[model samples]
Target: MTSTFTVLPVPLDHLFSPGDDINSIVIEALSTTRWPDESTGISDGDIIVVTSKVVAKAEGRVVEAASRESVIDQQAERIVAVKHTPRGVTKIVQTSHGLVLAAAGVDASNTEQGTVVLLPVDSDASARQLRDHVIDRTGVAVGVIITDTMGRPWRLGVTDVAIGSSGVHVLDDYTGRHDDFGNTLEMTVVAIADEIASAVDLATGKL
Candidate 1:
């Protein structure tokens, strides 16, 4: 027997806008990727990881580009740190999502001119909604994960991390399990959602 892991990037042919139905858009995009054998389409237990940008756009979280700074300030709970570079000022702050990240996850890339994308108000809820909608449309019990890019404290570059998840176990607990050395694992756990997001990020490249 053999086990394999795969991540397929869904190619979206159209640009998403505010008020767009993400559930339908996602289903449509996936439909184009189906194999001749319907059984090989989205299956039970498969996870669909989507970038937070589309989710934000669908949720009408866009603001004028000139308001980027002000919007970031408002999204932040508290400023953790700040840096002034040639481009401009960069801020690391704690957001309403309890995520301490740069500019509070308010992004200004890959969007329309003079506009910026804000993080979804509730990522977990967003994931749950997406998961339910996908299941309803395709009858496939798939998990959904919404991801955002963040710079780690000790890392030089940014990487995608899970901000929302549904129908998937986010943690893999290894407590009470013995290792090869027979040492009992008392406090071992893995963040499954974040790991999946990171893997998908590597496969899909930057958002």
Candidate 2:
């Protein structure tokens, strides 16, 4: 199957207030933006990812009257481990999904003072909803992926990760496949989604 991506450009820059809800803001952004049903000539199995900021906005996950520390406070229940570096990122424990970066998976860039944006309430659900909407709208059997910016170990800057996906498999295992030399491929599940996410970030200049 072929793979592709569609990145929406909204240029959102703001802070989420505590009173803000993450779900509503995301829906609102989607309503305002003209995300067409067309795929710009992409074939099936293409994954379309909207930046986490837009999703967070639509969900109304804005916080106010507090900084990064406060953002972490709300996520106290989800924190699994903490790391120390020039910048901070905690290895978080997730309930509905796997162990991710943080409670809200939030960061301190392109946000206003005393506020930060949290992740979508349910990334997979959000992706499914969007995918269904698109199918209903355009009859396209395309996949959808919701991406968020995240920091990586030994990496200098931030990049996108697949928080949501539909009709696409992030991992491809070839453990049983033998190499040209007849050596079995061992533990060969590639993070294709993440690789595409990084490529999209570069193309869209999401820095």
Candidate 3:
């Protein structure tokens, strides 16, 4: 799909206030905020990405770190029959994605004191809901991507990747489409979401 991406900067807002709902807040923002209006630049075939932290906050994933660590310990069974000091003896455990990660991708930064934000309990559901809601209201085939900061095992510096997606092709397979130079692609899964993530990162200071 042909898409023109304008870097819409998000201003500071009083997020995560008591009794605050993200879905409601975003819908309200769309309905009320003149800046994000369809005519003001962004439109169909375009993505609407709100940092996943906002979604976590909206879903009440906020929790005290002390309590959250304890919860993780309980959930972290000795899958490999080995245990070591704190943050040792890695074992991949099934996270929300049904894909295992060393520490369930738990995070401990960018939040209020003594609190850590967790991934949306059901991110796929969250994306689907947001996408469906937008389509219902705008009649536009916009895509939604719930992105989160994650660390790779052997890589430094965090990167944002799609934890969930809807109304868009998450991957653009190029296996059948050989390069003009005649190089046959083999065994590849292009991460389109991460590409968008990195682009937004450049335009937004959030990288």
Winning candidate number (lDDT): 1
- For candidate 3, write residues 135-193 as lDDT tens digits: 88777787888877655667988677777787767888877667679988876778888
Point to the candidate with the largest TM-score.
1
> What local lDDT score does residue 130 receive in model 2, on the 0 to 100 scale?
72
Q: Which ten residues in a row have the lowest lDDT in candidate 1?
A: 32-41
Q: Tell me how many residue pairs clash in candidate 1.
A: 0
Cα lDDT tens digits for candidate 1, 1-207: 246777777887668798999998888887766544544468888899999999999899999999989999999999999999999999999998899988988888889988999999999999999999999888999999999998888768887889999998999999999989999999989888989999999878864
Model 1 TM-score (2 dp): 0.92
lDDT by residue for model 2 (1-207), tens: 574435555433445444454434443444444446743333455456666666666667666635656665555556666666676545554434553565447655656666677777787787787777766655658677788876666778777888777777877788899888999988888887777677767756745
**In every candidate, how many clashes are there?**
0, 22, 0
Q: Tell me which of candidates 2 and 3 scores higher on TM-score.
A: 3
* TM values, all candidates: 0.92, 0.71, 0.77
lDDT of 3 at 103: 52
Whole-model Cα lDDT per candidate?
A: 0.89, 0.64, 0.66
The alpha-carbon lDDT assigned to residue 31 of candidate 2 equals 40
RMSD of each: 2.2, 5.3, 4.0
Candidate with more favorable, higher TM-score: 1 or 3: 1
- Return the candidate ranking by TM-score, descending: 1, 3, 2
